[model samples]
Target: MLMYKVTKENGKTVYTPHFPPPLAALDGKTVELQGYMIPITSGFRHNTFMLSVLPIQQCMFCGQNGIPAMVEVILSDSKKEKMSERPVTIKGKTVLNRKERNRLEIWVTDAVIM
Candidate 1:
């Protein structure tokens, strides 16, 4: 889950996303997660995509889930085999992108479908 705290710095108000200490500790570590892939592009063999805890119909963007339920996935092989609709297990190094307000909060780099 994510938490937010507002603070005034340099005479400007800033809103930041805060993860639980345990979740934040996972940053930069290799981890495995299971989810359904949501393609960011038009094809099935995508290097970059979104992994959702729920199916597309119940994704966070649809107002059915929270931000923690999705992650941005970047495959290690850009030309890897096309992904299936079924849930898949992926392994990669985790990245937390808290500063980017307009993007997915979590990212997995060098991901491989397992």
Candidate 2:
């Protein structure tokens, strides 16, 4: 998990995220995570989607929740399984994006539903 600290810099407040050595070491490594999928497109099959820590109704996007509790997913193949209402496990190479505050915190590529 990522940690954060708030501090004032150059007369401006800044939010800084701290990635522990272990977590930072996961970049580009294959990892498996379980979460609910939030469809990015309107279809039963999708190559890309958002994996949320909670159900879609309770996801960060639904409110002013800090740091999105979601990761962008890109399926390894176009032949992904049909979306399910329940939580699912997925495996893929992890990519951490902390440079931009507006960008996704994590991105999973070459992903497969497990």
Candidate 3:
């Protein structure tokens, strides 16, 4: 789902993603993902964060991964999870950003740790 085609826009590099049919079909749908939590704020428990496909060692924040490797996560109302090194399984509605290359490519809203 992270696959993209690189191109030149205004003499600057731009990445335009082409989502596969199956992946595209998941937009606005609930899906489960297993990943390490990358907090948006410094804390032990969080309601919003980023879920990375890779562990912190090679996470997006470390510059070892790209936008596709992570998804912004917003937990369900009043729900929070403690940050941990172990992977977590989350079920949420998927939001795909197909037009914005400078922002997160995906977001999981109303997520819950399962």
Alpha-carbon local distance difference test for all models: 0.84, 0.84, 0.85
Q: Which residue pairs collide in model 1, if any?
A: none
CA error at residue 54 for candidate 1, angstroms: 0.7
Q: Write the per-residue lDDT of candidate 1 for residues 39-74, one digit (tens) a residue.
A: 887865778888987777776667865743689999
Model 3: per-residue Cα lDDT over 1-114, one tens digit each: 467889998999888877788888999999999988888789899998888878887875577757437888999996888899999999999998888756677889999999
Q: Model 2: per-residue lDDT, tens digit, 79-103?
A: 5767777999999999988777765
2 against 3, candidate with superior TM-score: 3
Error of 3 at 77 (Å): 1.5
Indicate which candidate wins on lDDT: 3
TM-score of 2: 0.73
Q: Over 4 Å off in model 2, which ranges?
A: 4-18, 41-43, 64-68, 100-102
List candidate 1 segments past 4 Å from native: 6-15, 60-68
Q: Model 2: how far is 48 from its true place, Å? A: 1.2
Quality of model 3 by C-alpha lDDT: 0.85
Report how far residue 28 has shifted in candidate 3, in Å.
1.4
